[model samples]
Target: MGSGQSAPTERVFHNEIPISFSQDLVNRLEDNLSTPDTTPERQNTLDNHVRARIQAELARLQAEEVHVREQIEAVLERENLDREKALSGAGAGETEGGREDTTSGNVSSSALLQGDLEEVQKKVERFHVRRQLDNHPKVKDARDAVLQCYQAKTNTPLDCIDSVEQFKRSVAEMERQFVDSLRR
Candidate 1:
């Protein structure tokens, strides 16, 4: 009734619009308006058409992104296979004269051997400690006496209190001797 140009209404779903979508829409709108055939009367119609096209473009880009990610994963898997093949090929060419290639694999193998050596050393140390404990005359006699007492009084362990105490004292003395030996 007045000037035929109503006031611009506030957009209802402003927050729902993505920045990229809005930017593309704005660029297209600018292009459409700059053309000679465009008129102010058809601006809304052109804007609607541009918005639809932008939505379609966003969907296409998302699909392309998923496809590109899949391709990247395939390429990485292929590269890993090639690397394994190269390592195996290098290992096959090594001569059996105890001459090993100086690759990371050889280094890891040496590390594994070192770990095994350390484990063996620990076992040897344990064996020596056990032998020393068993070979001590006092400890050996006390252990044998305790075992005899327990066998004689299986239902009454309390009766073997003296032997148990002797075994404990022998163990303490053996530990002291071991520590003294270590200090020397």
Candidate 2:
């Protein structure tokens, strides 16, 4: 009506209009989608996916293990240096104790070095224990299995009963083995 062109239609709603398709085509699609997923090809695909995921997890754990090992080695080296310093300081004090002023200072410094060495040894032991646990195959496998179960069960750990039971069994077995080894 304006300048010989049709007027724009008045907008009724802000929502987008849904696309339409032929009902026959939609029915065919639904039928195809409803087919069972128990085919051998699908099973193999799932197996491959699981294998890839396990490999990725293993790689991540190995990297963490290496980093922890490096930290342990560094702590051990520092502990050794502290030990050497304390020994040398004690020797020097024995030679120089004729001067009363230096005797007190050397004793304090030696005590500090001994404390530092003990702290470093504790840190190294903690890292070593963590590395051992991380490298345990049963622990890793149980963790992975439980994680996968949780994912499959819609992020609910409570639904992973079998996995939790298996984990407990594995831990019990490990404890028994450790006890037997200790007895030996």
**Residue lDDT tens for model 1, 89-183:** 66434546443343444333444456657867976886687566658999889999999999999999899999999999999999888776555
RMSD of each: 20.7, 37.8
lDDT of 2 at 4: 42
Cα-based lDDT at residue 29, candidate 1: 88
Off by over 4 Å in 1: 1-41, 92-184
Provide the overall lDDT of each model, using Cα atoms, as 2-decimal numbers: 0.76, 0.71
**Candidate 1: lDDT of 137?**
94
Please report the candidate that would top lDDT against the real structure: 1
Model 1 accuracy (lDDT, Cα): 0.76
Model 1 weakest 10-residue run by lDDT: 99-108
* Model 1 TM-score (2 dp): 0.32
Q: Candidate 2's error at 32, in angstroms?
A: 11
